[model samples]
Target: MNTDNGLAPLRHRNRWRFSGGTVDLHRPDLPARTATLGAEPAPVVLDPTRTAVIVVDLQNDFCAPDGWLAGIGVDVSVLAPAVDLSAQVVAAARAAGLPVIWLNWGNRPDQANLPPGVAHVYDPRGTGEGIGSRTAPSRAPVLTKDSWGAALTDGVGSAPGDLHVDKYRMSGFWDTPLDSVLRNLRVDTLVFAGVNSDQCVYATLVDAACLGYDVVLLTDASATTSPSYCHDATVYNVRQCYGFTASTPDLLDALAAARPLDAGHRTAPTTPKDSE
Candidate 1:
């Protein structure tokens, strides 16, 4: 079916061709491999040196067992697993000397810059009873924006080399400094992990892909208010539209494989006399 953007519908067609007791497509270049009887292959490899891991909106409202949304009937069971997987991904990226950018939803008290209809969906109470109060302790860079309940929740801080970019819309690229930050870091690939897979995460990935960055969504490192929505948005839509989706193990393997060998090179040691 067509989506809200009026895109064409997807079709499923199965055609069988046999030649010499083997199935083949019309094209000779098409291998004799079976098309519908095997498991899907792993995602493509992503170079760590040219990659940046973006942790988006992992605040208490979404990740914590008790937060504003906790009162709602929203299913949050996936938050813990997503958080755990994200931590592992972050560790791997750090080890590889890649940049880790944390995108938090920071809101202002006045709420002047929030998007037009955002606050209607998520109203911020006077007591900070919204998405802004949730925070993690990873010290990742944070961007605080007053657009909706978009401020990074409390308790999350920035690390030694993290960056925070404030945004005013669902996509991080809309009038934000995200592009400049990625360009400055020489990052050509984006590894996305975060909350609301169907909403913010989906928008960001689509925008990144449109901006020509190789995007990979850590499927296990992100979630939505509903499991079905998360799966459809992250696993299905991202794979079909924006980029590839991978689990933590799959991403770790890709990063490990992308590592460079030492080439058996060694550095010379300094003399003891020179120390004196």
Candidate 2:
């Protein structure tokens, strides 16, 4: 058994713990565990070289004004600021030589797998647009694998070296290749930023924790049109149950510390006043 920075070695082969939480470090043979009950610890200082920023569900159907949520009268403007913040995180991650993984909700073309319970959320406006369903006027699929609505928003996009994974469920790990991808990359730390902080982002964050990945939630870079309470609950849950929450600026500082000579490493701007 070994310890570092007050973390006690676990009786289990791969788990470790500090005063506040437990994290099952990734290993090939065993499944990972998430968090435990205790006081939250100070935010983690990440090793930029070993971390990856996961931009989740930043797709047009979730973030853009002309997309499905907007067409249904949802005020997607609340999610607008995250677009730029996520771009900043991506840029910083790339400059630091960290992988930026875009994990978007990409449904199947035939709509064969979407369950009724999962499809009911889109029926509120009677637009009939749900998973794999197209919008009335523009005819874009709600979230088809290769369709426009499922693509990352205009400003938040994938770069040549960045990774892209299409997820089918709210939790990116469910029936997806996300776990294997991260494990294959040997990435143990995941920085999460994306749309609907309380929904898709939160789900993925929790799943990552359970899978033995150190998780960080970028508060400003993750947007949600859901009620403020939902956002608050997600943040609280993540901090108390999964991992720490941070801003884009905090992550930038950590990355900068790792590479002081990189002039391209810059702090992300504060989110606009209109955002919650």
Candidate 3:
């Protein structure tokens, strides 16, 4: 049972209670799982059990045709690839026993927590077409909590074990319970797939790395409405500075072989040059 930490009757990983005298800081009896992915700058090999997949800001407001980005004249069609790959990654993660977290930009209805600079950037002219403003014809507030604009896009489905976190800022960790949730789940690695590769996605991934979580950015599973240069540099920096960058297929291949699936692409584990 690998009961190496505490008394069997009171052991818990990342959890403790002052029971009688001894506390149970032992991690639960979860199976240790690992897999390898074909990645850039290096191949990726990670523990699926200690890892989580975070889909950031793929909400209707960011990717839907009639949503906030589109309302602001940003072409949302460019997000199709990201949406598809993210959906696939999320499904595979659920099957692999890895947690799937949807980090969406669902702001407070009153915009009480929204900073003035953020509000100005949304509606620079102060014309009331910004976040939480009923500027659109349908009058649904942009990214308001529990609003249609804050809902997941059509193709992204939520399963029973999936976790959802709403963030007011670009980084999901800031002013959110994201970090705490991940820690309690015993997640040490983050696989990110989402929109605005250079913006929210990048910010979250960077913060994840800074906070000591291993980060993997799925290249094909992320997209940016901005120019190609922004997307290119984001990937480059992820590999060069933050973490590794791998394709969606690589991740899926790793998960399938690592767990029960028999139909996923498979690859042998390889050591990255730097690690060797």
Candidate 4:
């Protein structure tokens, strides 16, 4: 199906494979593997020291009941499981000493950087209620950088050692230092978790894969308010074209297994309940 992007395969393969400056998923070595609908596989072991967990757009505005999404009438409760799973993933990743990068929609203070079309999508009232614009009733600014709305949700916060990237677009790489930061830290494998699985999270994963970073989507750790079919499509697209789909438990088990015997393999703790 031409899943790979035409890069040379790695000599020592594990669950993640490299091709044409992008990351590809191979049949994972772990006994409990996450389903990917149907995608071809190669293999590469995950290096904890060189891996990162990317928490995408799990901010107050998107996750909290009083936040933007809720205020806009979207059923925010759908993300409850995802929020819990994300917290667990963060906790485990932190314990494992893996870098946790929180990628969020943190727009500029002046809102000049927000494109009109993007602003219009969220500001349906035409009442100056746009990105960085304050809602009249609650006075919550849409998602200004450094604002409460832009902060990571209470349960899933950035640890002292974690990194934060304020992304202005759906894709984390757009005018953001995410790519450079990962390269600088020598992080080639990325585990994704966050809200709106079919949107922001999906966009960022695709970008990460295209930029040559191995990507894993913790399915249970991400949620989307979109229809069930939309979520399915996103997962299928990721497995077939971008990367692999795994539950938090699958990844945690893999990390735990790798910790004891090999320095190349690091940590993660506990199993996640199925979020589905």
Model 2, 1-276: lDDT tens per residue?
000122222112122333324343433232222222122357455555457789988888877778878877889888878988988888887776676788987878876777666677666565566666666334788888878787777786565556778887788998788888787656788989998899889989998999899998888899789888888888889888899888877777767666442332222222222112
**Model 3, position 64: C-alpha lDDT score:** 82
Give, for candidate 4, the lowest lDDT window spanning 10 residues: 267-276
Please give, for residues 1-276, the per-residue lDDT of candidate 4 as tens digits.
101122221212133545566665542232221222221243345666567899989888888888877887888888989988888888887676667788999998987777777778777677876787776224668888877788777566555556778998889998889987787556678989897899899999998999889888877899899998888888888878887888877777766655442333232221221111
Task: For each candidate in the order shown, give its overall lDDT on alpha carbons.
Answer: 0.59, 0.72, 0.81, 0.72
Give the distance in Å from residue 57's predicted Cα in candidate 3 to where it truly belongs.
0.8
User: lDDT score of model 2?
Assistant: 0.72
Candidate 4 clashing pairs, residues 3+ apart or interchain: 7-19, 7-20, 13-43, 13-44, 14-43, 14-44, 15-44, 26-41, 26-42
What are the C-alpha RMSDs, in order, of all predicted structures? Answer: 16.6, 13.6, 9.6, 12.1
Candidate 3 per-residue lDDT over residues 65-100, each given as its tens digit: 888888888889999999999989987997786777
Residue 58 in model 3: lDDT: 83
Model 3 TM-score (2 dp) = 0.86
User: Can you give the lDDT of residue 246 in candidate 4?
Assistant: 81
Off by over 4 Å in 2: 1-41, 124-127, 259-276
Candidate 2 deviates by what RMSD? Answer: 13.6
What TM-score does each of the candidates earn? 0.66, 0.77, 0.86, 0.77
Off by over 4 Å in 4: 1-44, 260-276
Decoy 2 TM-score against native: 0.77
